[model samples]
Target: MAKIMALDYGLKRVGIAATDDLQIIASAIGTQPTAHIWEFLKTYLAQNQIEAVVLGDPKNLDGSATDATAPTEAFANEFRKRYPEIELHRMNEVFTSRIARQTMVSGGMKKKQRQQKGMVDQISATIILQDFLSRRSNGLF
Candidate 1:
């Protein structure tokens, strides 16, 4: 089976993560500047056989879309337009940042590492991918 990629999009930087070829373990791919996202993704897609792309979708606590949602959805749309053959999925991104922080803490990350916002993005992408994998494993449409 082809691997999957997950993205945690920000205005300036984007966090990326990918699943193993077996689709069992998720790993942080790194963060990239918005200006280089397309090139980075093109190179990554060319190197790895990715079947789908998952993006973090921000929403309000009450399930309403947030202001960031607009740009995120736009990004997803543009990504679809650019990579028409790839499947794109948006996963609800609630508490992902918090979870990322907690994960860093639990992982005994250094202060400097924890202070880096890019690390949070990578962790967020991992969480997004994990959620997507779980949902797919359960056959949730």
Candidate 2:
């Protein structure tokens, strides 16, 4: 099966994650500067067979779109225009960053490592991918 990739997009950087070939596990790939996201995707897609792309959809506590929504949607539109063949999805990303932080602490990561924003972003991407996988498995995607 082709792998599914996820992105936790930020203004400064984008976190990347991908499922295994079997699509059974979601793991963090790395972070890329936002300015080079398209370039990074070109290289990544060239080397990997990706069937779909999942992007984090930031939302407020009351279920409304947050301030980050517009930029994310704009990015998604550009991504779709660039890669029309690949499927794109937006998964709700409420509290994924906090969850990632908690996960790091529980997983025994050192304070210094946990302080790295890139690490949090990567982990958040992983969380987004995992959520996508679960929803998919439950026929909710």
Candidate 3:
């Protein structure tokens, strides 16, 4: 099966993740600077068999658009236009950052490591990928 990629995109950094070739496991790839993400994607997409891309859709708890919503939408539009061949999907991202922080704390990560913003971003991306796989397997996608 082709791999599915996920992104926890932010203004400064974008966290990347991908499912294994077998599509059984989601793994954190890395975090890339937002400014350089296009270059990274151009190379990675060329080398990998990615079938689709999942991007986090930031929203408030009440389902209203958050401050990040506009920027995320703009990025999505640009992504679609730039890579029309690859399918792009959005998944609600409410508390992914909080969850990632908690995960790192509970996982006994060193304080310095846990405090790294990039680490949290990567974990958040993995969570997004896992959520997509779970929903798709449950026929909810």
Candidate 4:
């Protein structure tokens, strides 16, 4: 009944989300600065039984890797090195940010709140986790 976590990696901050032990719902955990992301994730995994990790893979509109991909990959590599016991998966995150922004707007967030980058990051992590959960539910991955 371990939970799965999703990470939306950025240079400055990383958004985190997790699913219930039943794997029925995704929830935004929080955003942490990338300065000690590995340490933070290790503590989180120790506290919560994390079975696997799903990472958002940035891509261009044409399905090519975005400029951010390099850093993201580096982060992923570091993550793997830090926690080799956990499984890892990747999901295309082409429009998660845009969709997160739209969702925030539709939810009536104020302009100032919307301006906070962590809000979008958290939503993006949620989106990534939802996508991963859906695919798992469908038995497609």
lDDT of 1 by residue, 52-133 (tens): 9999999988999888888898999999999998899989999999999999999999989999989999999999999999
Off by over 4 Å in 4: none
Highest lDDT model number? 2
| lDDT for position 44 in model 4 | 91
lDDT of 1 at 35: 84
Query: What's the lDDT for all of these models?
Result: 0.92, 0.96, 0.95, 0.92
- Per-prediction TM-score: 0.96, 0.98, 0.98, 0.95
Local error of candidate 2 at residue 73 (angstroms): 0.4
Compared with the true structure, what per-residue lDDT tens digits does model 4 show for residues 39-71? 897789889998899999999988888888999
lDDT by residue for model 3 (37-85), tens: 9999999999999999999999999999988899999999999999999
lDDT of 2 at 14: 97
Q: By summed lDDT, which 10 consecutive residues of candidate 3 come out lowest? A: 66-75
**What range of 10 consecutive residues in model 4 has the weakest lDDT sum?**
34-43
